[model samples]
Target: MNVHTAARIVPLHENDPRSQDPVLEELVDFVGYRPNALLTMARKPGVVPALLKLLGVTLRGDGLLTEPLRFLVAAEAARGARCRYTTTHLVHAAHHLGIGWDKLAALPSYLDDPRYTGQERKALAIATAGGTLPVREPAQAIGQARQVFTEEEVVEIVSCVAMVGWFNRWNGLMGSVLEPVPSEALAHVPWLKNLEV
Candidate 1:
């Protein structure tokens, strides 16, 4: 699907007095900057905090998935959803975590890449299945994934994909503009050329 050319809703600019919701500060601290999507969602007083809190649980809480693995899951889902904004953010985050550039650049072809562990490939496949529209995750894929990942780890993997699902839809619908940080960070990768927007 093509990215929307215009936002369905108007976004709040950082300098706008109306954008001064206190929760935006929390997001800034979380991400090192106020992403355009979060600032836009800050239009609703409650959403920013609630989303961040959920993100904390999904990303930072005790779980079988490592932070790097979680980032891969998120990126896979974002790419499947064709969401450049979300894809760029997660891929940029992966780079910061010291995951190899070639591994990241090879994400679309994970099945053949030796760099990705079997567990990582399973999670990526699940993420790919989950990210498609009409939301069809194959039973075989989930079952196979379960063999390698614990039931809790499967939940964590699905949770990571599910989280990006929200951002992918939100940013896709919002036509959210990309910020410079992730935009710049994603520049060196070839497969991520879609993120150049």
Candidate 2:
């Protein structure tokens, strides 16, 4: 039998009851294959399904944050969490949104980059501060966000960050293999590389 490529436990095969979820199918259609992360998370019974529901709402449902901004927020949060797995997936997502490699490459220096506009810079700052593990001094970044965005938009920014926070921790701790779709799409994003422990 082939070994589990990611996760502490084995992932479910296509015929597994838990793997038959519609949400999982949608994910497969979007990415061109079942992501191993979701497949492994499916092994737990409810996690992948529940997460997909939340993902549809937070990442897809109407929100004060623009669609493009949401991607940036998630990517920035993934970057802050240092979860290369999640960041790699976000790279694929960004491409679908018409956000380019160079634009994403600017993420490491987003705060001062000319590529990012004033509002994007504001959102990125909040993502960095809110996404910090120890939850550093977020007052300044959030306070700045409030000045430019509505309270709802600020919540959207923070919520998007919080949502990806799960993936950041889950994929990081599980050592989730970078799925083929994202692995091929990785380009040459240097900072997304996880350091060898």
Candidate 3:
């Protein structure tokens, strides 16, 4: 189950001063540890701070979507990309927010699952569109999402998906290693079916 790639890049170890940069500390605070993705992104100048800022704005939008629901949307996007890397983080954040492992394991059936509301379903659908791409009907996805969400709210949902899209592509290609806190905390990997890249 070693999912790493042959051309894997090493993340900055905690002892590396670059890993201790103030902006990088924000990621430490957010994830409760220095994330491997952030540590790797830190190798480039200014990417960490700017990306973290984008994360804050996207995840902490104008109070339209609840924080837990935001994590829910992210889970769908992670499934779309078949990224165990990002989904592991979502499970970590979800647990911190009091969302349970049972709920995470049930995500594949969200469309008919009683756990999600119509609005949440729309947002999840839109998120998957972005993550999986060339989504047969782009306009249809946006239209469906707009039905249950305001223009601003739709933008918020899109922001969540787009933000994760970065990680989906970067981590998938870089073969970024998953941190134990989230990766191991996740009880099961049912969101995507044999689709982790």
Candidate 4:
């Protein structure tokens, strides 16, 4: 077995009871495999539904934040929390949303890349701040975000990051394993190398 498999606190298999859950089944269908982070959360089955509901609101609900920006916030939050697992998943998700591969590959240098629009950079900065603990949201960052977005959009961005922040803590504490699907998809991403630690 791989060393990363040691993080499995509960069995999560095709035959596992939770794997049969409609929601879990939907997720499996979407990703082409069961994500190990969700499996860790599956240890307490009740948590899955609640988290999914939260995901529905933050990820799929009507909001001023665009889908791509929300994915960026999620990825940035995962990056801030240092969870390669979640970051990999978010990057895969970004690809599915039709974001350019070059931009995804250049993620490590997002702050310097001319490809990112002014709003994207500001949103990313907010995601970075929201991801960190001690909640270090700088005045300047928030000000920049406010300039680029409305108060409602700013709230949406922060809310999106906060959702990912919870998953970061949950998965990190569980030592959640990185499943093959996401691991394979993100294998070539240069920025992901920095998160191996």
Give model 2's clash tally: 0
94-128 in candidate 3: lDDT tens per residue?
A: 76777777767777887898877788788888877
Residue 125 of candidate 3: its Cα lDDT?
Answer: 82
TM-score-wise, the better of 1 and 4 is 4
Steric clash pairs (candidate 4): none
Error at 152, model 1, angstroms: 0.8
Best by lDDT: 1
TM-score of each: 0.87, 0.90, 0.89, 0.89
| Predicted structure 4, TM vs. truth | 0.89
Best candidate per TM-score, number? 2
Between candidates 1 and 4, the lDDT winner: 1
RMSD of each: 2.6, 3.4, 2.2, 2.5
The count of residue-pair clashes in candidate 3 stands at 0
lDDT of 4 by residue, 126-167 (tens): 888777887775677789999979988888888888899777
Better of 2 and 4 by lDDT: 2
Q: Positional deviation of 108 in candidate 3, in angstroms? A: 1.0
**Count of backbone clashes, every candidate in sequence:** 0, 0, 0, 0
